[model samples]
Target: MKTTITVNGEARALDLDTRVTLLDALREHLGLKGSKKGCDHGQCGACTVLVNGVRINACLSLAVMHDGDEVTTIEGIGTEAALHPLQQAFLTQDAFQCGYCTPGQICSAVGMLQEAAQNWPSQATEDLTAAIALTDAEIRERMSGNICRCSAYPQILAAIRDVAGEPA
Candidate 1:
């Protein structure tokens, strides 16, 4: 089947099987390999990407379903010369050890910030205050899906808090 999806602000047209996951389509078909294939079951979140400014596991979604949706991968965030705020914070904080999950972590953080900015309430948000205060628990809960085998949770949370402009 022929499918066309906008990826990283580019219109990608391809003929693919119905079973092709978005991760494979991005890495194999469109040559956008930033989204990793960690668990291939949506458990690892290594294939995390943004669709319409929301984070999702690419391995659990089909490519053809995102025909007109805007998908943003790690490459779309920033370049080596100009890194996004979250990216810069991650680098400055030394968030990752092995660096395998860095791309997904960065992308997830970008989407997470947007989600936070939108005042999306979480389970722990008992009081719908004027503005949501980014707490360490909130960050951890929001990023629970993205696992880090290196156990770099402290640095990752620090980086996110820094980008979020919240005192830790």
Candidate 2:
């Protein structure tokens, strides 16, 4: 099947197998290998990417299904000269240890920040009607999906909070 999707602000057209996972499409087809294949399962969140402005497990989605959609991988977020705030925060906070999951974590944090801006509620939000504060608990809850096997939760939370304009 022929699939065309905008990736990293560029249009990428490729002939792909119908069952090709989005992660594979990005890494293999488009040669955008920042999104890693950790467990090859959605549970790990190592292949998380922003599709249509929402964070999703790229490993769980098919490339053909996202035709014409906008996708942002870690490479799309920022460059080395001008790092995204979250990326910079991650560096300053030393949020990553092994660094295998940093890309996913940064991508997830990008989408998570958008979610928070829209007042999206997470499991930690007690009052659904109230604005969700970027509390430590809230950050943890929202970031639960992106697991860091290095157990860098404290630094990760600090980086996220820093980008969120909260006291780190």
Candidate 3:
């Protein structure tokens, strides 16, 4: 099967097997290595990416399923000269210690803010009908999927809250 994906604002196509996972397609074929392969079982958020402005685990879906979809990876979030606010917040907050999970965290954080803005219901939210608020509890719930083994979670949460305009 042939699929065209808009990755990082670039149109790219590949002849992939229907069984090929999006993570494999991104790393193996497209050479977008920002999304990690952590568990490769959808259990880990390491392979998370934005699909049409939503965060998803690339390993959970097939490449053919994303035909003509707008995909955004961590690399697409910003450039070396101009970093995304979440990237800058992560850097300033020292969100990662080993750095392997940084890509996933950054990607997840980017989409998370968008999700929050959309009034996505979270367990921490006292009122779901109101505009989503970025409380420390809510940030933790939204970022629950991404794990940082280096114990940099405090900084990670701080960075995300900062970008979301929620104080530490």
Candidate 4:
């Protein structure tokens, strides 16, 4: 299958097998290794990437399904020269220990923030009609899909709170 996906703000044209996953395409073909294949299943959020501003597990998605879509990997969110606020916060807070899940955590955080800004309610939300309060519970519920094996939840929460304008 010939697919063209706009990755990291650049159009990448590739002829890939129909079974090629978006994760494989990004990591193997495009050389974007930031998105890791943790569980190789949707159970782990390590393959999370932003597709059309929404986060999904890249390992669970086919590359052909994302043709003509704008995909943002960790590389797209920010660079070493100018880190994204979440990236910088993660650093300042030491949110990652093994660092295997940091990329997905950051990407998921970006999409999760956008979702919260749009008044999307999570299971922890007490009031569906009101603006999100972004309480600790709310943050935890919203980010439940991403798991850090190193158990850096506290620091991760601090990083997210810092980016969300909440006191750590």
Candidate 5:
């Protein structure tokens, strides 16, 4: 299958097998290794990436499915010279222990923040009509999909809160 996906602001034309997952395409084909393949299944949000500004598990999605779509991996979120706010917050808060899940965590956080900004409510939301508060519960609920095996939830929460402009 021939697929052209604009990844990290660059259009990449790849000739991949239909079975090639987005994760494999990014890591093996395009040499973008930030998005990890922790479980290969969608259960672990280790392969989360933004597709057209929406987050999805790249491991579970086929590369061909993303034809003509815009994808954003952790690399696209920020560069080494200039870290994304979330990335900086994660560092300031010491959010990761092993650092293996940091890429997915940051990518998911970017999408999660955008979703909250758009007034998207999570299960923690008390009032659907009210503005999103990004409360601790809200952040936890919204980020529940991405798990940190090191149990760095506190730091992760703090990092997210810092980025969300909430007092930690």
Candidate 6:
């Protein structure tokens, strides 16, 4: 199957098997290695990427399923010299220890921030109708999917809180 997915602000056309997962398509064909494949299963958020502005596990979805969709990998989030706010926060806050899960953590944080800005509710939310607060509990719950084996969770939560304009 041939499909075009807008990744990191560029349209990439590839002829691949429909069974190919988006994670494979990005890393193998597109050479976008920011999204890691920590676990082939969707249990880990290591393959998280933004599909049409929403975060999804690339490993869980087929490339063909997202034809013409806008996909944002960690590479698309910022340049090497100029990091995205979340990226910068992660750096200054030392949010990552091993750094393997940083890409997914950052990508998921980006989506989570967007969701919070839009007043979206998460499992940690107390009141659905009230303005969503960027609390540490909320951040933790929202970022629960991305596992940091190094256990730099406090720093990760701090980075997210900093980017979300909350106190550390």
Tell me the deviation in Å of residue 91 in model 2: 0.5
The clash count for each model shown is 0, 0, 0, 0, 0, 0
Q: What does candidate 4's lDDT look like per residue over 44-74, in tens digits?
A: 7999999999999999999999999999999
Among all windows of 10 consecutive residues in model 2, the one with the lowest summed lDDT is: 159-168
Error of 5 at 161 (Å): 0.4
Q: Candidate 2's error at 148, in angstroms?
A: 0.8
Error of 4 at 64 (Å): 0.4
TM-score of each candidate?
A: 0.96, 0.98, 0.96, 0.98, 0.98, 0.97
Off by over 4 Å in 4: none
Q: How far out, in Å, is residue 147 in model 4?
A: 0.8
Q: Score candidate 6 by TM-score against the native.
A: 0.97
Any idea what lDDT model 5 has? 0.94
Cα lDDT tens digits for candidate 1, 1-168: 888888889888889999999899999988888889999998988899999889999999998888788999998999999998898999899999998888899889999888889999776576877677888888998998999999999999999999898776
**What global local distance difference test value does model 6 have?**
0.93
Q: How well is each residue in 56-127 modelled by candidate 3, as lDDT tens digits?
A: 999999999999999999989899999999999999998888898899989998898988888888888898
- lDDT (CA) per prediction: 0.90, 0.93, 0.89, 0.95, 0.94, 0.93
Pairs with backbone N, CA or C atoms under 3 Å apart (clashes), candidate 1 = none
**Of the pair 3 and 4, which is ahead by TM-score?**
4
Clash pairs detected, candidate 3? none
| Per-residue alpha-carbon lDDT of candidate 5 for residues 53-119, written as tens digits (9 for 90 to 100) | 9999999999999999999999898889999999999999999999988999999999999999999
Give the per-residue Cα lDDT of candidate 6 at 165: 90
